[model samples]
Target: MKLSYPVHDIDNRLLLPAGTELSGDVLEDLISSNHTTPSQTLPLLEHGSVRKDIVKFISQPPYQLIFPEKQDISKLLKQMEKVQFVLPFLRSLDYFKQYDFTTYNHLLNVFALSTLLAGDLIPDYEERIRESAAGPAHDFGKITVPLKILKKRTPLTRAERDILDHHTLAGYVLLSYYKKDPYSLTARVARDHHERNDGSGYPRGINLNDRMVEIVAVSDVYDALVSLRPYRPISYDKRSALEEIVGLAEQNKVSWDVVKALIAHSRTDKPHYQEVEIPSEKRGAPPPGNVYGIIAEETDADASGTSE
Candidate 1:
């Protein structure tokens, strides 16, 4: 099969650009390399056009989400293009055939949703960009997980679950290694996105105080609920997904304010998703102090806990 997009090595070096036809030798080589050195996760280009289209959709007026417009889109794409390491890390899942949705698309959905929610809470432009970038990078550690575990339809065994839970820390390590920023928003999101506010979530069960992590965590769960999974045949509708998030908020598992923002943004009054102004009374207070500073103090060892 021909390459749908560019492929990159673990070092962020381009292996092949989009449109490169895959040959028997190339496929064999990739398979061999993958098996021989499981730690080196390669990146691949997701459908660039699809990414641009998603951005365009969210960028239109009635601007429901915190997506970039034409010029902003150009800048964001350029920024992402420079972060070539992200693709290879994500493309590791390309080898798994049973995923309900491509990792790239899933990440894209999370990024869009996270940014939308972030825009509602965070007025800083630079921070919004960081949250947008973190959405895709949040699952980067899944690269370290074995494909067999990732594609399994049955419930994971206790040991299997433990291994799988390590993906958060793995993702954090990968991003930190590549980006060289231990406290980078991308790295922190990868590690903390799976956490819950009530300290019931996995990886580390600590209460998440950072708004960005909270936004990405909520967006990740929302997308996962609405998207089909190999283990779950049916994908929940958007309304159901929102309901689930609201339920979590009610239970104190997620941020209520973020959920309110998500509900406002996803209002069904219009034909398309548009931003709706949530009442100040209903909205949660913005996180206290410099959130990034709070995040910087955290370490990977903190989120090292796993779930069953």
Candidate 2:
């Protein structure tokens, strides 16, 4: 594999330059170093440069990216700056590099969308900052899961499914261990983001009452739907993604207020509304049994098992 860009070691030392071809040994070494030293696997670029479209989408309030030509970008960058911790954590993971849905990028989009929605729901600066931090950290536990399972296109068996479902608790534990504030929103979000209002989410079947968790949950689903997965050939269109979210809201699985906030922020009805291209690896056929949908299968299975 050829390097798409220059990579940096944990100390910010240059390890490989752009276009450097990676042999089997070199690749293994790089992955090992990333696991041990916490370094970036992808080429280094200017901060706030990657995923411009996501920044563009969440350009309203608290999140701004200042550009000479486009001032709308200014807000998105400002919001990102509040949660700078996300970058290093993202850089340290080399496993996501082969997949279309890189954790780094997916978390960035989720963080941006969650914060944008947070701006509407949360008024306090401190609370909003907490939400910003929680957004990216929600999936941090997936680092513990094997890459093979994360990328598998086949339906996960019972054991694999159980392991996958534990990611929420794993993420929460990881964040709690490292975070100075024991009550940090980041840790809570990691634990509760998958929890639904209907009490059907994993790691806990309790209905979530926290506003921040609800916001991140909706954002997570929205991004996942629009992102290309290893199991799916193409990403869902914006309308389909929105529709799925709306359905969740209708079912009381997520907060309707959050969904409306996303709709308003998206402005998809506007003439200039544009959909960002979500990167995907397109690795294999769609997973059987539930079409590889994020929360649908679990919800359906739970629903079927319940007595009316």
Best by TM-score: 2
Candidate 2: C-alpha RMSD to true structure equals 13.8
Q: In candidate 2, where is summed lDDT lowest over 10 consecutive residues?
A: 270-279
Task: Give the range where candidate 1 is weakest over 10 consecutive residues by summed lDDT.
Answer: 286-295
What is candidate 2's TM-score against the reference? 0.66
In the range 1-308, model 2's lDDT, one tens digit per residue, is: 34443444333455555565645465445444444432222222234444564555344322232122255456655665656443445544333444534566677678767776777777695546645778877887676555666766655555455556666765654454444233578878887888888888876687976888899999899877766665565676666677778778778899877887776655534221123222233332322333463433445554343221
What residue pairs clash in candidate 1, if any at all?
42-88, 43-87, 43-88, 64-275, 141-171
lDDT of each: 0.59, 0.60
Clash count per candidate? 5, 14
* Model 1 CA lDDT for position 29: 45
